[model samples]
Target: MNADNITSDTRSELPQNSSADAAGEKTLKKVANRLIPYMFSLYILSYLDRINVSFAGLQMYTDLKMTDEAFGFGLAIFFIGYFLFGAPGNLAMEKLGARKWISAIMVVWGAITMALALANSIHSFYVLRFFLGAAEAGFFPGMILYLTYWFPERQRGVAVAKFMAAIPAAGVLGGLISSKILEMGGIMGLPGWKWLFLITGFPSVLMGIVTLFFLTDKPESAKWLTDEEKAWLKGEVEKDRLKAAAAKDSVKLFSRETTGSLVLLSLLYFSLTLGMYGFQLWLPKIIKGFGGLSDGQTALVTVLPAIFQALGMIFIAKSAERTGERKLHVATSAFIAAAGFVLTSLIDNPWLSLVTLSITAFGIWGTVGPFWSLGTSILPARIKAAGIGFVNSTGNLGGFVGPYIVGAIKQSTGSFHYGLYTMAASLIFAGLLSFFSERLLKKGTRIET
Candidate 1:
């Protein structure tokens, strides 16, 4: 055909293309509406269960007469089991399917969390925390992999954002509820921290049973979706797979490029986790250090950072999806978080410090969506399960290190300044590392047309 004839023909097909796009959009909205809220709730519970010890630490440490170092060690031990079992747990989920594996994981961890209330010695605390980590190891990465089944790369950022927003939401809910629960100390001869665990742990077990029936593993199996919608969704996801395959011929898990990318991504995540747990686990204590504040008041103030962080992350992830930019978003957020941490350490005014801490929380937690989206985008389909596991598992060691080092610093130095500075330094390194990640992975990735 002549050039003008071809152009005319293409123009004639535009209406059909537009109609198909509209239908696809509607289907995606339906899937997201059905899945995201439920998944979000699961994550919120997961996070609350993971971090509730921060609230409990208010009295638990005193009740046990544990030193700062011992308490920090107890908190850090969870990640040890988390690191060891993380990859295997993800692989188990891959073998068994999300519904069964995730449910089992929730039941196990929920039970362990409740058992934590029975801890009367530091050694018992250590063992329970470690087991808790092992039980919860695969859940986060499993959810990330699950999202890949439903959302294509273009929409994955926002999907991850919505799911991860639960982190901050958990903080808000955990803080409010845990504060009240802590006030119930000595009722029924049990401390309020004991109540916190008993109350929070039950819902996880209930939800685990609910998940078996509620979740569909893949769109093809989703009876709620029409055949056409299922086909369209699968086609979109396949396009992403094809694009990734085309970029790099090798899908070897241990190849130099793949291995290097894994290390870089792990380091990046390590920095984030360090900042996250360092700040989050210690936040209640930090606020109380401001003096003249009750545990309830401190918990209330802690929620402010989470609220701001939730809003910030959602906004940033939406913007990244709209712009189709990932690396810069991750880099910028890390830098912002690092700066906020540094500023927070320098400032003495409690209100101003809280504002800076909110900014820090915004940066630290905000990196979640774009960072994981970028990491997953770089990995080929063959290695996704192993790659995500390695990244999440190794990276979470920072979770152990962060709280430990912070506790060590607090015990020896009698201040949180050095600890905050250490966190700031880690975040700065992560910010710098994002550029290197772009160089390493960007060449192998192309935006889908």
Candidate 2:
């Protein structure tokens, strides 16, 4: 029953899957019941912290006398830090494990987010955004690695899907809250933008508390499980990881193979991100472009896509789950989004365009998480953290580039059509890569080659 004996016994049984009776299966049961929810709560908060800027951007631009380019650059600068520090931060997660490390990260970064209310100039925006990116870099990848320990190859997709849903869900919460907070336009010398930052950022204290109480880095360490239960849990995980390892040559956070795929995916993802982030970072701006929506209406409208996106995530992900197919869902979403972008560009009609955009939001951004789930299938279990981090962090370069890309195009041309078209390729590329990657996985016995 000792921890050492439990781990060794678990490792010894790595290749075996002995059927345990209900009583003997407590370990897997506990993980299923406990760890996923715990991680997800923190994930939701972490994501909210990182993206709170977009909601603030709705008002920040006008108040500070900042231009679209200034907003775009400030948004893009977040990724410069992501690019510079993401890989190293993710590597540290692998070495240090997720519990205490992510605990420290969540607390510090939450404080940083709350600090955003203090920004007075473009200089402040640039600095805060970068450090925020650095603070947030390892989260998604670290979580990806964390998930692999709990679920084997078969279940990892759905597990990841649930977490990925948080992105759109964040939009849902941000939209709902910012609409109310915007009414506080003249509270004690603080702008609505400042309130948005302060209130949203302050919740990390609660999130950090939950993390310290609940987050588990590995199965054997789960106090919720009995020693016998822990052994079985650890055994199942080690076996799955070893099998995944056998499927690839290496699984380091920055492995060459993962980096290669990450590069291609990032370029493609950048384009995809351009469309998604451009819209997210500028949804309020876009809605305002339609004329006469009023502040509250715009806030409500901004959340519409994310709401649709959450539903779209379920519907599309279900189809993927049923068919066990990744490409068609992704492709369909991308093409529909492309069509939405075109309609929004050409139309003078607000109602028609907003409807199209609603579909576009859910259809396009909704598919992102599921597509990421598809990427997990191709990863060997050993390097899942590094592989996903490389993919996510590198792909985020698009997030960094996206707002700027569209903002520049919109500023120069007085329209978003050119930028939309430029980003359209991202949708196409991700689908193509996913389609081919599936083919490659099927034809070969191993995923690493």
Candidate 3:
């Protein structure tokens, strides 16, 4: 065809193309609505069961006669199992299907969490924590991979943010409920901490059963979706896969760029987890230090920061999606969190400290959605699951290090100030690394397109 004829033909195709895009978006919205609620519920239960130990530590340490170091070691050991099993677990999920694997993981982890109540000796505590980590290893990364099946890149940031908001939601709910559960101490002659474990653990088991029936492995397999919707979703996914494949010819499973991206992402996540877990595990104790507050009062105080964090995360994720920007969002949030930590440490007033810490919570937790979006955006479909697993697993090692270091500092120094300073520094480093990693990836690397 002549050049003018071809141009005329292409112009005529624009309306049809625009209409198809709109229909695809509508289908995606329906899928997101169907999926996100159930996923969010499962995650809330998962996070609650995993971190309830922070609340349990208040009474369990005294009851078990365990030292700070011992408790810290027990907390840290969970990530060892998490790291070891994470990649393999994700690969297994890719092979076995998300429905079966996610359900199985929840059941096993729930059982382990419940069994934590029976831990009388420090050794038993350590063993149970490790197994808990192993059981829960792939759930988060697997979910991240699973979301890619239903949502295209354009919609993923908001979807991820909505689902991840469950973390902060769990925090708020766990705090409120745990305080009441703790009051149930001596009921049927069981300790409060034991009750906490038992109460929190049961939901996962129930949810796992629900997951078996409710969760579909992929859009192609979803009976609830219309054929048109399925076709559109699948086409979008295939386009992403092809784009990734085209970006790098013969992309190895572990290329230099892949490894570099993994390392940088891991470091970024490590700093985030360090601040996250350290702040969460220590918040109740820190509140108690303000003096004369009952356990219930302390728990109530702890909820404020989580509420702020949930709001911040959702807002930030939406902003990132609207702007189509990732790295700056992640870096800015991390820097805000770093500043919050520093301010918290410097402040003397108890209420002001809590407020500053709330800002810190907002920054660290807020980064989760955009950061994951950034990480997943750069990976090819072939290695996306494994890459996510590597980042999450290695990053979780910070969970171990953060809590343990804080506990050790508390024991030796008689103050949490040093630990707070350390967390602040880690976050600052994370922010800087996040910004530079984007530049590094953009220059002759497949990680940024």
Residue-by-residue lDDT tens digits, candidate 3, 1-449 = 00000000001111157789688768877888899999989988888887788888878988889887788878778878877787788689999999999999999999899999999899999999999988887787788778777876556656665676678888899889988887788999999889999999998988898899999999889999899888888988787667666744546658765777777777888887887788777778777777777766777788998898787677777777677777788889989988988888788889998998899888887777677767776655566645765676667778888888988888888877888888888888888887877576647654342
Q: Highest TM-score among the candidates is held by which one?
A: 3
Q: In candidate 2, where is summed lDDT lowest over 10 consecutive residues?
A: 1-10
Judged by lDDT, which candidate is best?
1
lDDT (tens digit, per residue) of candidate 2 on 1-449:
00000000011122234556453345544566676666666777777776677778778887777777788888778778767776677579778878876877777778888888889888888898888878877666667767777765454555665566566677788778878887687899888888878888777766765677668787677777778777766676688777766755543555544555555444545556666777677777777788887665678777877787677767776676666666566677777777777777777898887887787786676466446555555555567544555566556677777778877877788876777676666666655765565454334533321
RMSD over all Cα atoms, model 1: 7.6
The residue-by-residue lDDT of candidate 1 on 1-449, one tens digit each, is 00000000001111148878787788889989999999999988888998899888988888888988898898889889887886687689889998899999998899999999999999999999999988887887788778778987667756765676677789899888987888888899998889889889989988998998898988999999999999998998898778767654655678865777788888888888888888889889888888888777777788899887787667666666677777788889989989998998899999999999999988877677677667766655567656766676677788899999999999999999999999999988888887567565547544220
Error of 1 at 80 (Å): 1.5
Alpha carbon deviation, residue 269, candidate 2 (Å) = 2.8
Scored by lDDT, model 1 comes in at 0.80
For candidate 2, the lDDT comes to 0.67
What TM-score against the true fold does each predicted structure earn? 0.85, 0.84, 0.86
- Model 3 C-alpha RMSD to native: 7.5
Residue 166 local lDDT, model 1: 79
Q: What is the lDDT of residue 153 in candidate 3?
A: 59
RMSD of every prediction: 7.6, 6.2, 7.5
